[model samples]
Target: MRRSIFETEHEQLRDTAHDFFLKYAVPHRAEWEAQGHVGREIWRQAAEHGLLGLEIPEEYGGAGIHDYRFNAVVIEEAARTRSGVALTLQNEIVAPYLIGLGTEEQKQRWLPGMATGELLGAIAMSEPGAGSDLAGIRTSARRDGDGWVVNGSKTFISGGLLADVVIVVARTDPEAGHKGFSLLLVEDGMAGFERGKKLDKVGQRTSDTMELFFSDVRVPAGNLLGEQGRGFYSLMRNLPQERLGIAVAGLASAEHAYAVTAEYARTREAFGQPIASFQVNRHALSEMHTKLQVARTYLDQCILGVSSGELTAEDAAGAKWWITELEWEVVDRCMQMFGGYGYINEYEISQIWRDARIQRLYGGTTEIMKDLVGRKLGF
Candidate 1:
């Protein structure tokens, strides 16, 4: 699809990003998957290539660009490569919590390193029992004189094993309902801030996911991300962008899967005739192509809505759930056309199929997204 949202500069950015992923990420897939995490060098290399910080201000060693299309381009490129690169989400999606809510002092202290890739950041919001229910988290941060002592654990956190700074969500006042929660920036080297074993997963193995433990870890009062008792509101404010990010990834992956399958159908033979000649295969391909085109239109509109500050949480939820579900569906059907070859790990289709599964589960489950949209409809 010829997207109208991007200009020549964005096109150049896409080309550059595609080249970078081809060079640094593609060749290292097997090694990273075996190790269960990507190398830290890739992070710094991304920063050096000007791919790490698109939203950070120039004063903070970033480009300071306000466009979300560029961010979408990055996500799309990551999906195209299927290398499970997630730094863009860390930088553009999660880091905004501090950018929007942190004090000037906090920005001055963290933004530069974050932009330069010297410090990797992660947000700790989900607990073992709390996947979609943000209010059900049991992590606690108790006031202790000038500092707050945090306790509890976060599971399935992106960059959990490697993050230099983790924005931890905890209940500061158990009785205050949602108002009791706060976000505390937990830095590395802090007492009782330990990481659990790296998790094994079915897909996106190059992306780090692990458990974080905070047992009486002391965080200064100044480390608070925003107003006391307003962390829930602050988090809700950024979710639209996160869901948009996921949509961007899903559509890109679907497109790649379709493109690959189309080529396979043309070359691979069945009964001495190219599979592309068969009516059934042709119809399936046409349907997938049509779905992708339609989904891309809605996704581009969502991107513009978000960039223009007009996107609602409900629209984002709709995009996240719908696009990701489509992504998995399209990829699975494409893989089926590949026959037994798709099941082998050596094939990119197999990897794409595995990687697409988590899109509906993470960020937000499809069921949770429906509930969110339902609530917006006054349900």
Candidate 2:
């Protein structure tokens, strides 16, 4: 069960992150949940503590560490703590687009603020008409003199409510089909950019989820990310990393669930003995533990594959679907050990269960991931 992924530095990072979240983030979870969004203060605090932008360059106010394991440590610690902040959304989902695609001028304008956590980023993909169907996206950007005029809306935008910069996916050439799509950087207070109502979700209440409205907003040509009409491919390239992030989160949450449940079974009694003393309960815990270890092994390989640029979309899809589905089962089984307390909103397991549901849905639905992998297998 010992992980070979972390070096001494990685463990050092994990220890510091664990301590910081235990002190700062865990204590504020309730208050942040009440607001339905994490405060910018927490983001700034994380940055000040040197936890927010490990992948960004030092010139841009970051540690300039390119290792993905370091990134995984941040994500794993966040999930383990149930911090309710979507660091994955920022670090895994949006940072690459900025780092890999941003022009020197664009980097100058945005990267420093991002690395410093002064600017939060979000990638707007799903629309009112498109969730899994990227081809169905209706958000459009038309070429205007010296700029592009964008018009459309995005929903289910993670980190939307507070993002200082939103990387919007829009159709740039109506006739080019899939190649028509492009990424546009829409900054805060852009003339026609508006944050819609904060969505009320069943879980992960502290992470902001919302709709975004863009009405004939003029984005300077300079703000376009990557080559125009290459957005779809760009997004596809990033999907592997994004899905891997989800898988790691799934593993972390499930592991946390198991730890909590195992401790409960050891202490909570039934028939004058601990519930764990029962054969059926013991078997259930054993199965969940074995499943978790297996999951970690494969996921660790996927992490290494991704870090080495050798992980294929198919491999990432397999990890995302299998691990998330297993995550759900593991958490559900763990919750059963708590009996009625599992259903109570007060228990930590209850929140973990609620939050785990979306893992299979977002990034890519389990069904979609299966089909993707199936197709790659000559199905």
Candidate 3:
């Protein structure tokens, strides 16, 4: 099905983003995977290309475009190239919090570097004991005259190793439940702030994921984000957009997988004929094509709704889980079509298959998404 959500401007942007990734990211894939992270130069290049700060205001040296379609184009091109770097984590997930909630001074202090890719940002929310349950977090911050003392640890923090500043979610009032939580900005070189070793993961090998520790780190009161006790609400408000991003990537990856497999089936032979000509393989391709079309259509609608501010948390939950689950299924089936070659590391399908598995797990699990939707339905 043809997508009508993008205007000519978006298409033009897509071409530019595609070329950028092909020229810079494609050749470095092997090295990045080996190093466990993409080079910081790519981030700087992305900033120079106007791909890093779509949400930041023009005064802050960013493009100042608030539209999500432009973001979708970048993500689509990245997925097409199978770049495992986490541009979306910066632009799609963390930028909003900074843009939407940062004070003018905070914007002046951080937004410029973030836009220029000179300062990388990461959010510390999940801990070893808490994943989706924000209320279960045990990281605490206590008032200390002109500053706040923070002590806690976060695991599975994406971009943790490279982050120059981390927005840490911690409990400011231990007895106040969700209302006690707050967001504190902890910068690099702060006393007692440490980043753990990069984790070895089954997929997204080029994206850095690590553990972060804060031991009696003192953050100035100026570093608090939003209200002192409204951190949970802020997190809730931004989650819809984050999940939407994951959904967009899921659809894009599924489409890419299907396209690669379809071409493979066309050329690879069975019984001296193209395997795609066989009824079983043809049927599989047809099923994947249909699934891709349906997912794309729904994803496009979600993108439109999100861009216009009409998307709800429940709706985003539905999109995130359903589309990611479909992406996994589509990639797995495409891998199977490659027969023995799919199991080999050299094959692109193998990487796609490995990378697609995490979609259903991160940005909230499929089971958690369904639970959110169910609760919204008055279950």
Q: Write the per-residue lDDT of candidate 2 for residues 1-379, one digit (tens) a residue.
A: 8999889999999998888888889999999999998888888888887788778888888888878898888889999999887777767888889898999999888888877788899999999889988899999999999999999999999999889899999999999999999999999999999999998998888988899999999999999999999999999999989999999989999999999999999999989999999999999999999999999999999888877888999999999999999999999998888999999999999999999999989998999999999999999
Candidate 3, 133-246: lDDT as tens digits: 778899999999999999999998999888999999999999888899999999999999999889999999988899999999999999998889999999999999999999
lDDT of candidate 3 at residue 231, scale 0 to 100 = 93
Q: What's the TM for model 3?
A: 0.99
lDDT of 1 at 256: 98
CA lDDT scores, all candidates in order: 0.89, 0.92, 0.91
Candidate 1: tens digits of C-alpha lDDT, residues 1-79: 7888899998888898888999999899889988988888888888888888788888878888888888888888988
> Residue 201 deviation, candidate 1, in Å?
0.5
Against the true structure, what is every candidate's RMSD? Answer: 0.9, 0.9, 0.9
